[model samples]
Target: MRRSIGETVILRYWNEGFEVQLKCQVEYIDNRTQMVIVSKQAEVLNIEFRNIYETL
Candidate 1:
């Protein structure tokens, strides 16, 4: 599926050797780099496309 900025999504990624799920809003997407920037509350995160397990 195609995702855009300002969309809310659920992402599952490996963090500290653990699989964690984060619910955040999309801030930026770089298709060429396959990276996404999302914000959850006051925290901003950078995630890889491959690590995004789902969208909501």
Candidate 2:
């Protein structure tokens, strides 16, 4: 499944050996790098597109 900027998604990733999930909105996408920028609350994160577990 392809995701686009401005879409709401669930980002799942590993942190401190534990799985963490965050609800964020896609802020930007770098197709060349296959990286995505998402924002949750006041935080912004740079993540791989594949790390986006689900769309909401």
Note the Cα lDDT for every prediction shown: 0.79, 0.74
Candidate 2 vs. true structure, TM-score: 0.63
lDDT of 2 by residue, 1-56 (tens): 24557878777765556677888888988889988778988999887766555555
Model 1, TM vs. native: 0.72
Model 2: residues with Cα > 4 Å off, grouped in runs: 1-4, 15-17
lDDT of 1 by residue, 1-56 (tens): 35457878777787667788887888988889998888999998888888766675
CA lDDT of 21 in candidate 1? 86
lDDT of 1 at 2: 57
